[model samples]
Target: MKEYSVTPNKNAEGWYVKIEDVAPTDLYSKKDDAIAEAEKLASNDTPSRLMILDENHEIVEEKKY
Candidate 1:
């Protein structure tokens, strides 16, 4: 199954939505915005999962579509 992830940017000032095995979307300054976009993309692209990562890059939440 396809998977998407909401991960913190390197600077920790922004977030990005990444589709597994594909290029990630643009950076988002707000976590909500990033997750929102990821959900939309994941739902539209395929039956997938949305994984929200914490500051330490650990999976904090996972939603299956």
Candidate 2:
């Protein structure tokens, strides 16, 4: 299964959508945007998981596709 995550940047300036074991390619200014993108990616990649983290890097929500 594949996995994707949406986390706040270290500085809290933006959000990052990251694939498991891969570096993020884009940073979204809004957390919602990041989550939306991650969800789309996860849905497209069936048998995937989407993890959403808060500013403190704690997993807040998890969804499986």
Candidate 3:
């Protein structure tokens, strides 16, 4: 089994999720969406880092060691 960290970030509109420290796609509009996608990727059991951003291209959320 694989395990990943999920965190919610607050921005101008609402909260956003940053999965593993990589850039997020348009499909991810909020925290929940990012986490859902991350969950799927985590199933692969591969290490990953994601950094979700907002409309302003700023980091809204992140997961670090």
Instruction: Name the top TM-score candidate.
Output: 2
Q: Write the per-residue lDDT of candidate 3 for residues 5-33, one digit (tens) a residue.
A: 44444444444433434433334456576
Candidate 2 matches the true fold with a TM-score of 0.94
| Candidate with maximal lDDT | 2
Question: How many Å off is the CA of 7 in candidate 2?
Answer: 0.5
What overall lDDT, based on C-alpha atoms, would model 2 receive against the true structure? 0.91
Would you estimate the TM-scores of all the predictions?
0.90, 0.94, 0.37
Q: Residue by residue across 1-65, what tens digits does model 2's lDDT show? A: 99899988899999999999389958999998998999989999999999999889899999999
Which of the two candidates, 2 or 3, achieves a greater lDDT against the reference? 2
- What order do you get sorting by TM-score, best first? 2, 1, 3
User: Model 1: runs farther than 4 Å from truth?
Assistant: none
Better of 2 and 3 by TM-score: 2
Model 1: per-residue Cα lDDT over 1-65, one tens digit each? 88999999888899989988367778899999999999998888767999999899999999998
Ranking by lDDT: 2, 1, 3
Output the worst ten-in-a-row residue range by lDDT, candidate 1. Answer: 18-27
Who is ahead in lDDT, 1 or 3?
A: 1
